[model samples]
Target: MRHSFYCFALFSLLGAAALLGQDKTPPAKLVLKAKTGNVTYDHAAHAKREKNACPVCHPKLFTQDAKAPVAFKPPHKKHEDAKASCGSCHRAGGTAFETKGNCTNSKCHVKATERKG
Candidate 1:
């Protein structure tokens, strides 16, 4: 009976450790599609870059739903006037590059190459 109790405690501890490990795991990238292109967002990378400040954007700039509809419609505007879109960051003097004149940059856009038959 004592050996069984020890085994149960060991298993419980292991289970708890596994759960804790998941809490630190990085989140998968979220893809936001636009008429001109798609934006791949690595929440984990951004969180790490921001030192894991979830409250900085949670329920405020962005919601918990990674698939939530962005505040703007597409075609990728040239100006950064939409506060609830990717422009929130990809604007002039923003945390990221400006989307106005830098739309074709590889970091913000993945240009499609011509396909051969």
Candidate 2:
């Protein structure tokens, strides 16, 4: 009985460890609505750029919840000056390109082309 109990306990601990080792998958893309156009955020690409370091943005620059608002509204200089939201990196002289000249041509705000079916 003692040996059987030890084996059961060991297996239970191993099972828990296995489950904990799995990483929570993030969304592939997130479409944010805007008056000018919708922004398609490439989550996978960002994750890859960051080398899958989730803490770089999660619960800090942005939340883990996809449904949450990005809080990046226009007259964007406010957020850019503060280094908040997307402005944290996209600001002038920041890590990513600034949003000024690249608004429509960039991958950020995309005007939807009509689909013919």
Q: Give candidate 2 regions above 4 Å deviation.
A: 1-23, 115-117
RMSD of every prediction: 5.5, 3.9
Model 2: which residue pairs collide? none
Model 1 over residues 1-117: C-alpha lDDT tens digits? 999999999999999999987654445787777656666778878888778888777777777776687665544454356555666677766888766765557565565678999
Top model number, lDDT: 2
Q: Estimate each model's TM-score.
A: 0.60, 0.76
- Least well predicted 10-residue stretch by lDDT in candidate 1: 72-81
Return the TM-score for candidate 1, rounded to 2 decimals: 0.60
**Count of clashes, each model:** 0, 0
